[model samples]
Target: MSSPSDSTACDLYDADRPLNMRCACGRNHGRGAEIEVSPDDKLEASLMKALFPVDSVRRGFLRAVGANTARAAIASVLPLGTLQAMAQDKAPLEKTNLKIGFIPITCATPLIMAHPLGFYQKQGLNVEVVKTAGWALIRDKMLNKEYDATHFLSPMPLAISMGAGSNQVAMNVATIQNTNGQAITLANKHKDKRDPKMWKGMKFAVPFEYSMHNFLLRYYVAEAGLNPDTDIQIRVVPPPEMVANLRAGNIDGYLGPDPFNQRAVFEEIGFLHLLTRDLWNGHPCCAFGTSAEFIEKNPNTFAALVRSVLTASAMARDPKNRELVAKVIAPAQYLNQPETVISQVLTGKFADGLGNIRTVPDRADFDPIPWQSMAVWMLTQMKRWGYVKGDVNYRQIAEKVFLLTDAKKRMKELGQAAPEGAYPKFTIMGKVFDPAKPDDYVKSFAISKMA
Candidate 1:
């Protein structure tokens, strides 16, 4: 059984706070105490109330604190036995023989490997792998119900949950798919080894306009002392078209995931500038998300689906499962690469342009605080950039996007351990961020354009 005083990092509050004080540490609070509620803060608080009404009780406890904060905190207190029971005792999902959608990329390894290796089956799921053109298309499919769920960029689901991207029904990320596989590739033309200043007039492409790939690129250019919007024109292009765009000199550089990053180097189209892993340690790059309706209608399937991801991720992380993943992702339509290529990328090895080869850093080995913090950070960006129209509370939406309680329950079932914080914490670009201090953390970043 769990107690309110327990110190699990997933525990939203400690014994130190006023009982009525909320744990807004990550998703709900804005950094620390806002001594005075500005118009913006008032608007943020109002939006929170709309999503999680102030009067709502959580876990049978009338909220003594902020509603959403209490809602999230109470959800995190589920006992391990109860979690296992939820997985075992719930009626099997309405749709067990599931056809899941994914873009053909290495990041979808968990779903691909899970399906063939019988991991989903072990969790009582019958999963069929469906491929999509890109993240945008995948989003549409997930929204249209063409897919039960799909491996998605973590921010996409959050974007939806907050009503940032589409007014369609909200979706939620049940678990992280894979992290740290994305990279920013620069065209060789912009790769002037002799003159670093030559990049003063270049266009860099990002897969989506308001995406982490774009955010990371902006941060990188800012760190290099260049204006992201003015110093270098940032172009928006699809991931598959990034290399071709580079080859055609349509854009100078772009950020994308593995294989595409590798293929660019292999074909001499661009120079790999930096992997996201180098920028944000263990950033939650992608996840498995489904609509709220799907979840409410089929809780049993949701638990099973989460269990499958856990098992598959464990296998992919384990050296013994390397051959298994290679075999699973071998279909030409999928990762569609040779066994050696799949092996190299999946286990963190990469092909150098030279005859020599080496293992690049593994970015997936990250704590969970980064995930929680980034959720809050993305919301800030959305508001700052006008991606979200009208009055919307950033903090309230962060709660729905994060779904920390569900993630914790799933993690507990997987037996995979996370860091000792209620949320994942890490430094990005040398700035230390604790989700507990979301507003301060957002302020710490050099870019303050998030409205």
Candidate 2:
């Protein structure tokens, strides 16, 4: 459905206008002026025919609005590229029924809620969002392919991929499940010792060694002139047991995921000292991903899984939906926490264990972008703390493990705002981290274990 500039050009054949030209300078165009007929053009033509099979009606419609205007109107209603992609992406999933592991924490809000909300089913994927015991088990299961996909600490994938704490298995973080949802909680007995300088020789628990909890805690105390390695005891305590450990005096405090932070406050055993977001706003805590092998072998299924989680992430981002999400994911099958504690964590209105209800709405967020720069920062920390030795290819490892570009592309396709590329700078504890100068950034730290 088009009109040519030259009066000599006759319309294409159907019922109204008969074809007059064959393959030549005039073919599918005016005698002199021409417009390229693209595949999009063919698609539009077919859609036009379907809409108005009677050629006279189609001709009248085009005459009234003109081809350019008509195209603009239709495209505004339904983008042609999106429509074509939807039509073409109906491939059978290589693996439909899948088990996706998750630690029962609010950091996994999107992945956990996707199951109850049927977002996975919408993509024709039957997903079981299994409540996992801890982060190490999540890693082991992923390594064994016992779980098709799982919730991961944002740094876990990078660590696992580099063989930092486990055997090397190539992993890819598809999307950050949640951000700014972790906190440093302290035993109520030590509430007077809010200063990190006073925390010397104190025992602390982190969900995993390869976690933002560990990195951020190290960074926090390190900035306070306390070497996290020698001055503090950082234990790998499972999140579910963090509150119990705090209650039993097994650990003095923890930099851990919620609703455990809120759980400790609710149980009167601990108080929230500072949210990790205070250390670095919009910092990624947990990620949703599968191995690179899984993604390659089950591209369609992986895409479906990503689409489902992203849909849930969008839903969870709205503050209005936080309470609903808390309710949805608070059942015994998911986070297994009290609704009030989960609500406090998700809605950001909670007792700080010192007689104050803090209302910081961005306290937790579902920012799905797995920024590669975050990976770069994690790598720098690994090197700084002697977790990884020798020369490290920060950018190469970051780009391979954190699928930021793919996340952005998928976000764009999902009609979400895909922020510009991967390596945006981050401000942590008043220090600017330039991803391009990761080595310098690490060396700049005063209390690192770097040789």
Candidate 3:
């Protein structure tokens, strides 16, 4: 037997596990009845007691105003739904405050947009997306623990982990930030010399030594029968300065990230010679990652970060939503470019700076998967260029750094259609790259720095 005063009857009333002889409390002439007290009913009771404070007054007020009227009054003033959510979600975060670094490029679309849209807050994180000056600064900050995570040029983690261009620090790429969002832009002065073979004796710029921009530029020039080292000059320049440098005639052209590539076109200084997607249709350009040490210390925080970014990635993948996304990220605090320019870069329709409008929708895509094979391909380039010397255990390094399994798990949890397998073959410039035989692929390159 249970009375209305009993918490078991008032709060823990489960219909399947009903208490025998439950008091109806004046209902049906005081007969025992099967009753179910909901969470709302319990909340209403608590709120009523708080409002009245005296039992006699609470009973009198409820009797006069009625339960339905009381619930409406409580909900209007108190936002009971928010209270319920706060009560239900009590998972303590390992870290709530974090700083993420990024360059002012459209490649950082997902991570950058997550800030303004409250995705980080939704996961109980207070993330500050810091705008970095250059790739070297981004690497230095990450190494010194100044940034918890960063926007990495996709090959950066592989290079940094292998001690190629910097002191070795283990980094893990959580997601490929953007793919196919880069272009080979030449100054308008060299519009007649569009062919790569003619690009010999010309100075070129890349964002970093370990960037896909560098490798792709090297591959493109090599295919045209020119040694990238001897026949031409390649310099490392920050993405934001790429257009300004071109305008000042500091360099002939650059294979750089957008909205800078588009910025070059927008400013009328350079023309889009070719999109990198023309060289390798889906080549990865930028990535979002943190140190492996950070992941080990704050696994939950890292998972939340990935979720926040991936959610933005899923939203940005829709072509119709791109213009809206551009508006959100183009303000001073984020990418700091004109909305129209960012929209042009994101929406994939723009002027080529050569008197024509071009539309290539996958020109920029938010594919979050960091395939291990992508890591292996990057490694082969690193070896071929002598950035890494001798036999590389390609598989071991690829699996350790890329984190394909974790990405797929998080994507599936968010109901995004994630693919199976860690390795997928890609054809770059009509040559099929087999990730399984990385050594053979490295040797096959005709003008490799490899002995």
Candidate 4:
């Protein structure tokens, strides 16, 4: 094989493979050798164009978000020593040593992993992970800046952005935090009637009536020819209480996040009918969202935050990071399951009550770009359900709420990869599916209305 240092025009030098393809530039390498230049190398291009073909710009609007390279270019004009000192003395924003709220779940693993793994400290940020009771609290605290940010539901940002439950605030979501951890579970009584067509009437519990979970359930019920408003009843219940309610027969079914889904299985209280991710492949599920003001006032700080989450997300997606994530997410304060149990959940493996462990099939994972699509879809559903006022344009609501451009800019600065090769894309149930037109996408949904 040709050596990378042979000057073939690629900017990487190969090293031994058994220990991973380390870069000759002295940076520890993992699978990054597959890319021409590692983003950690401080290369000139934004992380998006580097990993994806530069031609992808024609395909997606994310590429339209310009790079803030003027700062770096301006720094290059300064004396070398001055640049070095500037880098060394870069004090963190007054926002350092802050608390960020999050609910306990496997999806919150990235935030938990970042702290002990040194991602936050590396970015010159000191973040305390505070556990909250519900999304409403997470939203309230984040809005007031009482908590810097949170491991929030993907819809939370859009909902807050549109002022769905409160005031309109410009929030920024740059990186998709985690995906595909949600499930729609049915009580044991309904397990035999797995096919929705066989059931005439059923009651479902969603964390909130207007959340993405609610819309997803409505969509699935609609697919089954059940009218959400008349055929099925959707009640609101916290995720942690879902398993108990299912066991006690208070609710017919529940849509919830894991390890609660895992807990139901372990306790033999409910059977998972389908994972929420199965509703739409590769959908935008959850992300790191902050205020619009935060992005403008502290671009560098915001970029660093994006980079930290990006790094954590990459690690979470890697198979080698299983034990690390399991240990972080399965504490008594978090999931309350054993690390081994959490490990199985992370790897998509499960143990039934009879001590039979099985490998679960690969499910569709979350992608960043789908976040905007999900927001738009939610807007349509809100209007359809009469949750929000009439005459609300979903497209306009999506643009105002989801800050794809701001996130793209930050991703480029930190060298994190971005969506390319199509501005209008949709992810349904963890699959990177696409629609020809936005108007057609909304019209295709029978349970939602046009913007």
* TM-score for all models, in order of appearance: 0.73, 0.81, 0.81, 0.73
lDDT-wise, the better of 2 and 4 is: 2
- lDDT by residue (1-451, candidate 4, tens digit) is 1132333223322221111113445344445434343333322222222222232331232324322342233223212232122235454664567677777767677776666555666567777878787777788898888987677777777767767787888775666666666777777767578798765677788876656678777777777777787887888787777888888888888777777777877788777777665676554556777787776777667666666666567656766545546765665655667667577677777753333565653332334443565566666566666677656566566666666776666556445576653246666544343433444554565654332
- Clashing residue pairs, backbone N/CA/C < 3 A, model 1: 9-421, 9-422, 31-439, 368-424, 369-423, 369-424, 369-425, 370-424, 384-450, 384-451
The local distance difference test score of each candidate is: 0.62, 0.82, 0.82, 0.61
Ranking by lDDT: 3, 2, 1, 4
lDDT of 4 at 103: 74
Q: What is the lDDT of residue 357 in candidate 3?
A: 91
Instruction: List where candidate 2 sits over 4 angstroms from the true fold.
Output: 1-89
lDDT of 2 by residue, 300-378 (tens): 8888888778877987898877876777787788887888999998898989999998999999999898888999999
* Model 3 TM: 0.81
RMSD of 2: 14.1
Candidate 1 has a TM-score of 0.73
Stretches of candidate 1 off by over 4 Å are 1-90, 193-198, 354-356, 361-370, 389-395, 418-420, 444-451
